[model samples]
Target: MMSNSTGLLLHNAKDDDDEQSPFEEVAANISNKDDPTILCLTFRSVFIGILLTCFDSVVFQFFAYRTSPLDINIGLIILLAYMMGEFMSKVLPEKIFNITINPGAFSIKEHALITIMATSGTTTTFAIKAITVQRIYYNYPVTHVNGILFILVMHLLAFSIAGILKRYLVWPASMIWPKTLMSCCLMRILNIENQTETTETRWTMSRSKFFWLVVLFQFLWYWFPGYIFPLLSMFSFICMIAPHNIVFSQITGANGLGLGVLQFD
Candidate 1:
């Protein structure tokens, strides 16, 4: 009787495993588990989300006209939000004026919510492009009020469309967004306790330390190609060999066909 029960339990476990999604990364990183008691829409999450959104929108819009534009990707935002969330959890008082402020440790759900909000805000709206084109190319004056209304309407339409499609696109288990999966994995990693000790790697460096190290290296290295020597941005040997040759320039120049351009930036 004992042997039969054990065999039946193993069979059920195998069936459960087979029913899981085929994507190994998704299965490994994402948990099917949920805790309904956990707080998601806390003060920290809202404040951090709005702050990062405004920051990202302003920075990207300001740098859009530059020869090399800069973008703060969701991965960086996840890291920043994680750091800020942790900081707030530790610094903020538990309760003030009969209200709860710090709600225990930073949770993965709160981090994911903040990340989604921040990511949504970073996207450039189509209305901005339309307004710019009308004013610049068509010479059509777009008043401030009209421009604001246009943007608001466009956003509303986009949200409405997304809501209509949510059932087919978002609810399905097969709908695995690779970019969002990456953010999910990052959130899981950040929320894990004693990650530095639990993780075994040859690098021997913590994730935060490694992140800062890479940022520092990129910052110092970009100067060479970005400003110090712009030519280094696109080093075409063929163009150098035949500077006066229009055919060679067209085939290999950075601004042209770029057939054999070697760029570091």
Candidate 2:
């Protein structure tokens, strides 16, 4: 009886240790907890999501024609959605036509849903590219109705393929994507409340404050490389030293072979 009890205790201890082991990247970043009461598909979220989607699609498609296309990433959309949600909460009346438009404080779930919708809209579909190529290069003009159908068909096909491969590609523990992890981390950081208690650091800044500061710094810094001095974008000292040397250009030039090239921008 004593021997059996000892063996059982050892087994339980092993299980406990396994439970307390270092978490996987997905588990570490994403929360497993679900709040049933949290409103995800509220009027405000849908409104903001659709609005941003239209704005992003138009802006992105317009920029696609430019030499340097501008892309509105998911992070920007997330931040924008949060601000809009907050604004609506404060300005909008509690009940309109006996319907709850602003459901108290903006929940994280709503923020996440809006982010997903806005991000989806920002992506320029392959169908658009294919249609453009067909029309311009092949000289095959498609009717407006036919173009819409073609886009729909392409999307449906893609969704079907994704559904089929999801088990192997998405559900597996080994299929860890760095980009997905980064997005999840950003979402968590944005949603989490700032710690009021000050730390012992020289500059005690909140997460949101730090994020905005970085954005401001990057915005100011980009002007130098992007417009003021384009050469600063790809400054290769070796190429400057030997402008006429083919070997040096091949090894150090940004447009060439670029063997030992380093870009600061």
Quote the lDDT for 169 in model 1.
85
Per-candidate TM vs. native?
A: 0.72, 0.77
Tens digit per residue, CA lDDT, model 2, 58-94: 9998898689999787778888988998888899888
Clashes of each: 0, 0
Angstrom error of the Cα, residue 185, model 1: value is: 2.1
Every candidate's CA RMSD: 6.6, 7.0
Query: Against the unseen true structure, what C-alpha lDDT does each candidate score?
Result: 0.84, 0.80
| Tens digits of per-residue lDDT for model 1, 1-265 | 5698899999976664455556888877777656878899998999999999899888887887689888788888998999999999999999999888888988888898899888886768889989999999999989999999999999999999999998788655566889888888777767863245445655566565565678799999999999999988899988899899998899989989999899888
* Candidate 1 Cα misplacement greater than 4 A, ranges: 1-19, 65-68, 193-265
Runs of candidate 2 with Cα error greater than 4 angstroms are 1-24, 65-67, 171-174, 194-206, 227-231, 243-246
Clashes of 2: 0
Maximum-TM-score candidate: 2
Clashing pairs in 2: none
